[model samples]
Target: MQWAYLLGLVAAATAGHVSIPFSRQDYSASAALVKRQASKDITLEALNNLTGGGYYSEFSIGTPPQKVSFLLDTGSSDTWVNSVDADICNNQQLQATLGTCLTTFNQSNSSTYQLVSSDGFDIKYLDNTEISGDYFNDTVHLGSVSIKNQQLGLALQSVRPTGIMGLGLSANVATREKYKTIVDNLVDQGFIDRAAFSLYLNDLESDSGTVLFGAIDQKKFIGNLSVLPLRPRQLATRSHHSMSGYWALTC
Candidate 1:
């Protein structure tokens, strides 16, 4: 299930790139578009937000007119951006160097902004610096899709680079009430066929990482796989237990 959450984060951050045009002067003509087959390799790129956070499988964000990267974490439930102008705690020194804070979009620019909840979740380090906030409803654009009033986390704090986005199975009341997830938005807009996606995560040092939509890359697996039954209620209960244990150990 943790893998599922991380896969969601990767799916949310995945972006399409235009292939470089080949020249006919020196090289033979080739296909204008390059489609990569799915594999088990972990994709690598500079996740702008994950600078000092750690070496993580990275993906690019194509929204709000900014490039940001993040660690594919499934343990958290909201997404946030770190602000450079906010005050920082002594213990947050390490994260301070990871990435630049985003300041372009603020409350004033969003016309339909609504804060979801205040008592959502909190993350802190031993140095006393922490990040906390609740889910928020706002418009987020990815690729050609513009998700209106989507539920996302907004963090208010002086931290390193861009904030994080949670991809856990646990959903906030508002999120559940509205049935919103990055995948859901994509599906609704017809960018992807379904809410299910697959991630090929390799060792941190490997240069291969990819996310598959609608179908898995058959070559990556040893044999055929079967679909599992949906168990939303059970998944939610397990998420609660796991989160409680994680917070207790970290706090």
Candidate 2:
């Protein structure tokens, strides 16, 4: 389910104005709080000409961690990869065009794979293509942080083998058993302080961007940081009660 809330930051202001550099904001903190503060910067590979036309990030799954490229998206919440058993995933042309089709998840190779449910996993994309499979809990590593028992879907039926890494809020997370998304685990495990991240698209032609977790890079922005609230999305008189996902700002 997707829910929209104003994306506002509560930071201490000096001289009745929020500080620029973002990191320069002065706020009283406990000694223990200062000790537990941590952050991570994840470099996203720009995929301008890819089928998705966005960014991709590397993620390792399982105990030894099998490396895979995930489509970085904020619109969905289910972090899923293609399984070897997918029926419609054997398109040779798609494999050549999109490198993702050649990749497949081998559960037998993973020692940390824990089956959550054999049923109740399904996802429908914007193209009206659906992928369904079993849900599993395994260890996932994003940068240096090792998240144990992270819930992810293993697609058994998919048109394309490309996997997506959803960076949306918990309200939009897709899972029947109710598990924590990667961002939630990051904050829960103290890898990041806040639930906010910044994505900077450096080159439009390259379709490249940089994603910073927990903190924003001051060098990315040219001027002052204009923080805007995330207003609730209301299309027509009736709100989309079931349409819960995506970072949509009311224009």
Candidate 3:
């Protein structure tokens, strides 16, 4: 049986390339592609647990690779970084206090950056922190490898000085109106074989952890991983919209 190559990461993204297998099961067409096999788990980078506040990771965006730190949030579906014109970053009071929200993105600096929408991203969280920005597509480097033309948000009116890299569901949320997300591009652009990623946070008292995008570190756990089925989207969404889109185990 032929297997497909896995792409990108959690902490460290892979530097490998993805190629579709030529011969499919359907046997409808001729062998135009090679029988590509799945590559071993590729690593991207490690997550730095900042004194137990939250997990932060480094990502280089744009052509020249401007490094930035974004808090990895799974609760929200939108991934947004502060723009150079971000209100909080420019404001005197909020500027000094914006911990962990460091490094705003500049579109003009990157040669590969492309503007998709002028006002494509606007989101408000449960705490009423509203973020509004333009939609942009650029190259995002997980570690050494790159995911090309990944669409992301550039926040201009954010409360936090730092940015957010949310890995939640990409549809029917704040970002649904915008273009495809990094994760979406990760799969479509052949970064990963499928739409699955594993986050290895290690354990409590661990200062450093890693996020595996398209692969899993089998050595992290011993026993076989148990598969839990998720609740139906329609049933889960019927009660509350907020609780529905996310992955929830059904007993």
Cα distance off (Å), candidate 3, residue 34: 57
**Global lDDT of each candidate:** 0.41, 0.60, 0.60
- The residue-by-residue lDDT of candidate 1 on 34-62, one tens digit each, is 11211222122222122233323322232
TM-score per candidate, chains pooled: 0.52, 0.72, 0.73
Better of 1 and 2 by TM-score: 2
Off by more than 4 A, model 2: 1-50, 88-100, 232-244
Off by over 4 Å in 1: 1-64, 83-85, 89-130, 158-161, 170-179, 202-204, 230-251
Q: Candidate 1: RMSD over Cα atoms? A: 13.2
Residue range 118-225, candidate 2, lDDT tens digits:
866787754344678889989987766677888888888765546778777666765655678877777677777666666555544433455556665555555455
Model 3, 52-140: lDDT tens per residue?
13656778889899988777766676677888888877787654443334588888899999998898888876433478988888898
In model 2, where is the ten-residue run with the lowest total lDDT? 16-25
